[model samples]
Target: MNTKKKSTSRIMLDYLFRFKFYIFLAVLASIPVSIISASPAYIVQKLLDKVLIAGNNNYLLIIVVGLPILFLLKGIFYFIQNYLMAYVGQKLIISIRYDVFSHLQKVSLSFFSKKTTGQLISRMTNDVNMVQAMVKGSMTILNDIISLICLFGYIFYLHWKLTLLVFVVLPFIGGIVRKFSKKIRRVGHDMQEKMADVTSVMHEAISGVQITRAFTMEEHEIERFHNKDRESMKAQLRGVRVQSTVLPVVEFMNTMGLAIVMFYGGQIVINGELTTGQLIGFLAGLGMTFSPIKRLTNINSVIQQSLAAADRIFSLMDEDIEEGEEDKNIEIDDLKGSVEFEDVFFSYDDKYDVIRGLDLKVRPGEIVAFVGPSGGGKSTIVSLIPRFYTPYKGEIRVDGKNINDINIKSLRKHMAIVPQDTILFTGTIKENISYGNPEATDEEIIEAAKMANAHNFISDFRKGYETQVGERGAMLSGGQKQRIAIARALLRNAKILILDEATSALDSESEALVQDALENLMEEKTTFVIAHRLSTIRKADKICVIDDGRIVQLGTHDQLMEKGGEYRQIYNAQFYFLDEASGE
Candidate 1:
């Protein structure tokens, strides 16, 4: 999440090494292409003197034939080199994208909670594309370098004096480009960050559009989006301005170099120290050299931008994953569903514990209901059962084996959880129900849906089981979403079930239907229920009253009512409210 550091060149070098063979081939191919391309300038000088100036007809024919041949070879080598370099660049992008995606999957849920989906999506999409452009687009600079070295070497062999004059401008151009690059890199980093902010805002607004409309906040949301957009635009414009200056500055130095070459070369020819052909050849090679210099100078901005994107991507990949023994598998066959918590304690942060020194036990097939005031760690207790978080101290045993030692994947396979908020992906009704068990047969899915009391409503839809659920099932009402979620859990047919305020969102009629379905599903299975409504859980086999992260009382609902403890007070409040409503 921190953007304090820039991506190192060493990392880019390492990534390039992934396709080293292709890069080497591309670089090597540039050698032949450079030699062929440089030959045309030298050939033009010879033809001007031998054919046009001297009127040598025989020599002119040979030069004409050879010129076309040289160009043909140059084109062939250029194509091969460019294509291979492009291939390598594409391969490198693919490698980085795959590693990022795989790493994200292994990251903890806490990482997701702290970051926005839009920010993460921007890193995956826009950032990766920038890196691809940098890699592929920079190959021209490499080709330019090859051509420059060849041309310069030949020019020095012909006349070192004039070459030195032309080379004098090189240091100044290098310094200017270096200065421009530093500022461009800073701007690029800022632009990428601002772009991420824009993406985050768009994602939030789109996902929460209903809430915005309900609160009449459309204007405010649009203004917030515009602000993020304006910031991103400013940063991008600054980058463009810096990049636009690079080429013109290179061209200015190149013009000065050319003027110096023509003046000095003319004097040498006038003094009879150099032939007209040699002077022309020198000037032609000088022109060729500037092309590479200009290209390399212009490529600096794009390279810096890519490095900025790489920095953001690598930072995410470098985050530490939740620590656990690798390749360890927990084996449990025919579990009896006995669960025990001994002196369990947990906290999101070390400084404050949410569940402290908790101890409880449930026998096989027992139905236990947890009742507590808000923030009493009731949901947190159920979350621990599926290893959403590990206890800071003490041990939780399932069927007499420590849960940590059990294979996390296998342990979760035997449990199903329905949270207060129901989540359904975009799919058909049948697909959503069968998601609990992807391999479930059509008959099994229908049975589970019937048990959840969702079959009737689904059958009424024109599409029936094929009915499409919009994004996150937005088309479904709150009660319908809850029923479908319960059906999903029921389809899993796990040995243990945890329902956290599952019926809280349902209307009275929907609640009765879902509660009946729940009662049926609880038969012969271990169930842990967390509910704020005392009436809904009164029929639970045992009610555990939790207060301040500890169980203050545990008994049958009638026993707790008779004892007049925390459970009694909760029951009296709910019972009186219901009685007053009915005018009893």
Candidate 2:
């Protein structure tokens, strides 16, 4: 949805400014190269008119020496021009790549949530590569224009009448190219979008290959991929169709001009108004002119492609980040870990509230458990404490100060979360454990791991703490992953800890081990536990049963049992289900 329109000229000018010094050098080098390249036609004209016509053998020696020297100079200038342009192109790519990556870091989580990993990866790789191609390809356009000017000047000097005749067809060519350019730009944008789709599908299929195979959905996935591939192919062919039409039209026009020059110039020569040498020079210059003109016409496509990529890049750069006010002169040396939600209301969308008029307080070092149905907003409440999402209706306070007034960075620094779905990066065991506190020493990492009951199993591995956990800790079992996640949270030693269904994925044995670990970790921290398993929260200092985004019951386990309310209903249901299953 985030997209913008960027002009080709504007994008081209940005690149020009980005590589001004090198472009200037390239242009300067090109001027003399153009002169030297154009010099050959002039030399040939002289050889025909002066040396051969006068029957003079003396000028032969001059031609042999002068021609090679001209060629060598041209070659040297050509080398410098290419090298400088390449250097400029590479630097521009580097700068643009850095800008895109930096912008990505600043973009909010919602931006990523709406975008596919493949689409973003394609932009960073394929789209950026296209921009690079545009930058490097632009050097040819620059050289073509320079050469066209030099050749035109030579042709005009040889015979101004014919030169003028050749240019008479240019306006018509410009009109045709302009019309074709509009079509090219449309197809180019569509093509880029199609490519993004293909990348998205490819990324999804690859990442979920295991799931696909388990469900025997390989054929279905292939069909889906084929559909995307077909769309991309169609878009590419559409682009090619536009290009194919434009080039031949320009070439046909060029052919017509050449025909006119040949017919009229032949009459002039026969009438003895133009000499053979002058006519020959004019034809040679005219031939040289067509290549650059054709090249310039072809550049329309590259310009359009670069403009399309620029639009996507700028759109990402323009995303509005969640605004946070700067906090100054307010520093809490010691956080008591008390959190209070005052009439807090939140929603993914403004029109529909998820957590409305919710007020609660948790004292420091207290273990408060929130038990609820799936969509009761239990996780949402815990998320607010970390400032992941701000409440729209009311305020949340930490240590009696409005959380919005606190530095978000400083507020988050004192809290740690162990999500239901534990995430571990691709790294060694020690590295993932110490991720929450990179400054933690080796002894501290081992201590935290031991506290989570992960040290024994990690020690059993061949590399012990040095064992590399595969991507997302896939090498570890589910319980192992949870244990490492707990170790990570423990290593943070944060004043506030949140366990969001942290033990849900573990087996009974593993859950018991992790429960003991959680009990140990929750000793002094103000902890909020979100759980559906009632047994796990029995020892919680306070248990709040949430239903339909409201706290339906708040009491200790025994008190909630005595109330015979919603908590009792859920507890009885689970307890009966477990009892019946065990009897069977």
Candidate 3:
């Protein structure tokens, strides 16, 4: 890997630097804003000395007119600086959010298995939003630092002796800010994690509402959600308490320094060491520094929060995407549906093997049925065909090429899958049918739907193809959704097909209709079927009875029946209940 992982602060700086031109403009505006902030103190001195003390009434009009202009210029610069900083900050956040979202699309499926949907959502939305505060915090620090320097310089110019007294409070203020920073960063990080827990509970409750109602566990789910919500509230309150106390403590320190300067300056004025106007101007300059000090303290809190958020965002971005995700490897032009598995051993977790020493060879346009008990690695065997998981001990080849040597996208293009649970997005009937082949024409989509035995029921709807299917196709019946999924597979028209208990959830009549559709789809393609219903495999070209991750019997249905082995016993056991019910 050529890429080096970056620290969160460095990553944020890189994003901020992308809009350096805007930052430069804001900096330029802040310079004038800083100078204007100190101008009022100078004006107060001239007004007292020339108009009041010296009785020079002519200078009164100039000072009166110039005070408003100084403040007006400050207003203009402040607006320019704030607006520019905000624009740059918002742009920076957009870039970070985009990177986070784009990175997720390429990560391996295993990454998702180990993570929850709500945790990812919280990082993508809440964490990214929090990082935006970094921009404002940075700009506030920059502006305040410049303003503080100018105000202090004005005070030193007016009276050098008193300016030295201001340094007395500096060390203690520094100690206080440093003391709180680490604790603030820790709590801020903790608060964000608690909020993610709250989000996770909300997501689980919302997504599983159907199951919740069916089980009559509404009260249980509500209590679960409430517990998470209360934890988040406590965390938020802890963060707020820490943040609120910082400003007051720092302000109190600034007030103490101000009080010392006021007492000493009064003594100087009484002793004829300084004029009343010069004293007031020095005090005004000293007073202006308080605002900047208070603002800098607040910026520390903002920075700590942003740091907490950036840490989470970068952690997600750094997750490894799928191996060989780039299509540097190549495969065949015309894929023949031939497949061979040579001593393949696989595992979902590294410790336990799910498919052990499995071997199979399939000719082009052949139907291979895998019939086994639950957890017999039937689904795992088919999943290996599309290269969803790699076998550690063996190889799977398609059309004379090892699947590992083929581009992932190119490898999966010549195949389609109909899972036990049909997954359909929220869209119209036509959209769901054409999901696999979005470029398919309306006529082609209708033809595929008709072949899947879904067109008749779809046409019965008032809006026909345009009828809405709610989230996960909730508005449709189980058989309707399964048919639409089959239609999606039909639209793809791939060379290899896998039916993973497709008709297992349907009623007998619906199963027959879906079975007919499956038969139509099986023509001219190499098919792999993992069926719970033994009758579904009686007409299959070959039936492989698998148990304990090994194929115990492999033969045609008649050949297996004649052998009188595991396949015969499994078929007898399944049909015995059906025969008894029918009074056979």
Candidate 4:
């Protein structure tokens, strides 16, 4: 589904229309509240004219009883209005947040690479929250307008001439609002950007805390955060400055208009052209009208801020996700895993190709290993197998079927990946192991753990399978975490396995245990191993030595060693030269 970019107004209007029923009820609730709000002025006018001046005790009963009834009804309707608006605001926020997060899952990995975690987090949290406030402000402005209209109707009934004069100064106030609106929006955008920066800095500091402490650079991180904090503070202050000028200017205009009305209306009363009750009632209605008007004016700044936030949120919602192949809906469950890459050309940046015209084939159940220097596109090849990225100009196939024709979810279901960096959620060991195959029985989970060589150590703990591994499995040692990850993959029992430099960072003892688990896991599945250590892939069925984004040597390790090519050079560099240097 292609989502065209939406304007801020259109996006807001979409949500408004989606929940129109609630909005309608809320608007309906505001009508009575607005009518009752104007009642106070009318009641006061009646009390003055009939009770005080006329000395009519008959008006006292209405004042004492009718006013309370109106007040009670006003309170009830106001609660309805407030509750419905809040309900709409909260509903919109939750729906949008869900869409944003779900949309992110459907997008390609390229999107994540381009966006920082903190920036995305801010979009979900800060941006969504800002939109919530915007919704409330919009509802407030609507209700205020309704209230203002009701008050205006009463005032005009009392004195149409004075009502016209009150409207005279409104143009000037609106002009002032228009003049400051762009500047306020600019400041608000800056403030949001600076806050995102602060969030990014905090994320980096927290994630890299170990590195910072190891290098004794805590003060450096603190100073960096301080700079971002100060920038955010300055941006907020600028927004505040622009917003502060708006209300005062609006209030001053209102005061001047009120003074003119008071003087002219008082003169009319003295000339016996108007009754004191009418004059006071008009003034009371005028005061009520301007209160909402003032609130409406202040809401302008909040509206601008929300529009800025809305723009960002809509932009994110419009980002292009990885689309499925056009009209191709082939479903695959159990794959034969006869993988092949034909004339594949790929590039992270178009200028520099990462996988250049690469070609390879692995027979079903073959154990193929890719060995290469750091930048030689080894990881890129395995990543392409699952369509994490698409080739610039080539085709990838599994069992003679073009990968692009396969449903992405169905294709991925047959493959399991244990990456170099193992990530585990905060959960019990049993939960982590059963992450991939959630329906696995306890016996099956323990069997998979045993196959991964994780069962012994796991049982050593008092809680066994129920032991909690803290955030990202922080409570577990590196080898323990890696084994758990492998156990998860083992439980998946996928037809194709991708081991990406799995044992590169482990100690010798841990590497041996992980290698034993790997040997067992690779028994019958077609495996693609990305080997960093030269010793690991010696027994692989086929070894492809990659360099400069192309395979330069292809053979078994023994064949490559005998061929005296790039493969032999790498092997000697790691085995012979490294051993000799250590001896020295």
Candidate 5:
């Protein structure tokens, strides 16, 4: 691996520099516009010197016809310059955005755990947009610089002394621009942060609208959004205040320089030291020159703002992706579905272990149930089997082969997990059912839906299998979403299955339907069921009572009840009402 570090400017330029042909064309197109821009002054010089002073009809006619023709050419070149430069800027933004999004997809889940979705969204959208603006501004600055040089070349030829005087305020303009650039950059960063806060608040409020309305917190949420919006406004105002101040100061200095040049040049014209035409042409060129200088100074602030955004974007890109298990070359095609966790220790954060020295084993086609209090690592244990996370110590094996030795994709291909919160994408019912098996035929999708007890309700919809499930399945009820999720997993036809409280959130009728579907789905698969309701797992081949990240008791339902341990206590606590109703 090369250890050489690249500068931020170099990294950003690499993207822009890729389209050298487009940039070259833009620059070449700008040249004619720059020359044409300076031509009017020279044309007026001829009109005044040769026509008015010499009483020449030829010079007058040329001036009348030439001015419009020159402007027309300028317009054509200007259009080409603008179009090509904008094309390059937009292309650069597209490439950068693609890189950022692709990198995000490859980064480990831990990276996401450490950062909010809103922050990531802000980086991909707002930061890239700022960079886009800077790229366009850069092209404008380049064009202005070229135009300034051409204008100066003309003015110096007419009067070198007066041209020197016109640049008197250049040092002062530079100082003011440097000072203001810092303020603009500082405020730009603050504004971006405030906008990110607003994004986060919006995401939270939108995602939790149900809870907010249920708890009568609509007004509170409105106030929360308002506070974030106000902060963003304040930051924008500060940036505006800084930007607004710089332009006036720059204009004042340019005006001062223009005044000195006019006062000095007038004396020369009066003393017959210079011609009236020469003075007029020199003044015109000087004015054109200073306009670009002022804009370039302002452009410095824009560049600073873009650099701040680039810093944020590049920092995100530099994050280390999760690395483990990829080096393992073993491939598992026909897994026997026997899974074992041998003294596993794992944690989301290194500070505390959520799964500590835990061990478990399940044979092929066996149904094992995990019963634990909330946060007892039940879900984490199941997540490990699919390589969503890796244990800090010890090893997990499937069919006597270390899981880390198996290709992650191949390992996961043999397993399917139906989480408590069923996440369905915004697509047709057929798409959702075949999510796990994209190659599934229409007939197979229907079969999977039927197996999950979802066919009847789906067929009742106007569009049937093609009916759209709104974002995250918002168009469907909780029971319907869970049923679709089961249908998705069933379509996979994996050797190993995990059911994490699949029926916990459902009503009695939904639970009955889902439970029946689950029974069919788990018929020949090695199943791990994490259940909060003890009654649901009473007939499991093995019930493991987990406490404080360890399996404290392992036995069948009748054996655990007879043993009278933690399992019995949990079973009694959950079913005590049923016993009371039956007068037990």
Candidate 6:
């Protein structure tokens, strides 16, 4: 989906409209609260004129009885208004979170490569929280606005001439709000960025705690986290300074307007142009009006901060998640193991081609190994077969049909990968094995684990298959994790397999057993391997030597050895020490 560069208001409005029915109820609830709020000034005018000055005891009992009933109704409606808006705010927040997370899953891997786990986590929890406050704040503003309208109506009824003068102070208040708004917004945005940095720093330190202890870098890690936290604190303090100044400036403007009303309204009463009760009621209503007007001034700060948060959140929501994501209309129920790359030109950054006009073909049930120097694009070649990345030019065909024309999920369904660094989710051994095929029976899971040589270690534990792997399989050793990964792939029963140093972590005995198991598993499958150990791929039908993004040699291992090139050079580099020790 293309990113939408929507305005702040539009972004908020679009979501609010989704729950407009509830929002309407909340605003409707506020109307009664607003109406009851005007009752105080009217009651004051009546008590002064009828009960005190006119000495009318007949209306005294009615005023006393009516006052309590009016307040009781106000209390009930106020509760309704507050509860409804809070409910709406919470629902809107959940919707925002749902969409953001769902979108993250659909985006390409490149999007995740550029983002840190902490920044994404912070955006999900912290930034979304900030938007939640904005949502509630807007509803509060709306309630205050309705109150202002009611109070001003009563004030104008009491006396229009003086009411016009009160409005003169409005333009000044608005000017002061405008003056501070930009500053507050800038500070708020800076504060959010600093906080995200703090979260990222903490995440890295926590996740890499073992690395820190191994190198005795605990003090350094602690100091790094402290510095990042302090930076966030300073940004928060700057925002507080900006917001704190806004209130007093707005307060000063309100006090000035009230003084004008008091002096002029007092003169009008003395001159017999207005009744004393009417003048007092006008002041009462005007005082009520100023409270909301003052809140309206502070709203500039709330609104600016909200806009800043919305800008950050909406930007992520608007990011273009590249085309050809999972779940396309095209599905492949049957797949031949054959894959061919035709004149592919690729780049991680478009500046230089990583694979310059490369071409390769793999027959069904063949083992193809890629051997090269580090950063020679060996891994990149295997990565392209899964469509993890698309070639800038040319086509990758699976079963002789362009992969771009197939459903990504369906394309991936027939393939399984065992990455160089094994990642096992926090779960039991049985659960991780069944992750490949969730509907697999317990017997099938045990069978796959046995094939990968993981069943023995798993059965040795007191909990057996139920033993926890901890976060990222921290409780398990490297070899154990790798075996489990292999078991998962074996259970998947894919026609196409990718093994990136799948046995690198295993001891010699385990490696021998796992290699045999893999050979049996790879019997009728097309497999791609990025081999660091030259001896591992000796039996591969085709060995390709990749150098600086192009295949420099391609033959059987023995053929490549006899041909004498990059493959032989890499093989010699690995066995050079052993060759010297043996005096070969």
TM-score of each: 0.89, 0.91, 0.91, 0.95, 0.93, 0.93
Q: How close is candidate 2 to the true structure, as a TM-score?
A: 0.91
Residues 307-351, candidate 6: write the lDDT tens digits. 787677777877666475544677888888999989988898889
Candidate 1 lDDT by residue in tens digits, 288-373? 88777877876778888888888888888877565473655767767889999999999886778889899999998888899878
Give per-model CA RMSD: 3.5, 3.2, 2.8, 2.3, 2.6, 2.7
Q: After superposition, which runs of candidate 2 have C-alpha atoms over 4 Å from their true positions? A: 1-19, 37-40, 51-59, 325-333, 502-505, 575-584
Q: What's the ranking of the predictions by lDDT, best on top?
A: 4, 3, 5, 1, 6, 2
Residue 189 displacement in candidate 3 (angstroms): 1.5
Which stretches in model 1 have alpha-carbon errors above 4 Å?
1-40, 58-91, 327-329, 460-464, 502-505, 532-536, 569-584
TM-score of 5: 0.93
Q: Rate residue 193 of model 4 by lDDT.
A: 81
Instruction: Name the weakest run of 10 consecutive residues (lDDT summed) in model 2.
Output: 1-10
Give the Å shift of residue 288 in candidate 4. 2.2
lDDT of 4 at 558: 80
Residue-by-residue lDDT tens digits, candidate 2, 334-371: 89999888888888767788898888888998889998
lDDT of each: 0.84, 0.82, 0.86, 0.87, 0.85, 0.83
lDDT of 4 by residue, 228-277 (tens): 99999999999999999888889999999999999999998999877898
What does candidate 5's lDDT look like per residue over 1-584, in tens digits? 11127666888778877999999998898888878876777887887889988899988987888788888989999999899988988898888888888777766677888888788788888889999889889877877877888888888888888888876678788888888888888888888888888888988899899999999999999999999999999998988888889898888888898899899999989999789988988888777776788778778778888888888888777875545555878888788899999999998888999898988889999999998677788888888888778888999999999887787778889998888889999899998888889999999999999999999999999999999999999999999998899999999999999988654467878877887887888889999999754455775888988888899999898898899989878877776676577464
Q: Which ranges of candidate 3 are over 4 A from the true structure?
A: 1-4, 55-59, 271-273, 502-509, 578-584
At residue 473, give the lDDT of candidate 5: 98
lDDT of 4: 0.87
- Model 5 off-target regions past 4 Å? 1-5, 324-326, 503-505, 533-536, 578-584
- In the range 215-280, model 3's lDDT, one tens digit per residue, is 999999999989999999999999899989988999999999999999999999999988999999
Clash count for candidate 3 is: 0
Measured by TM-score, the strongest candidate is 4
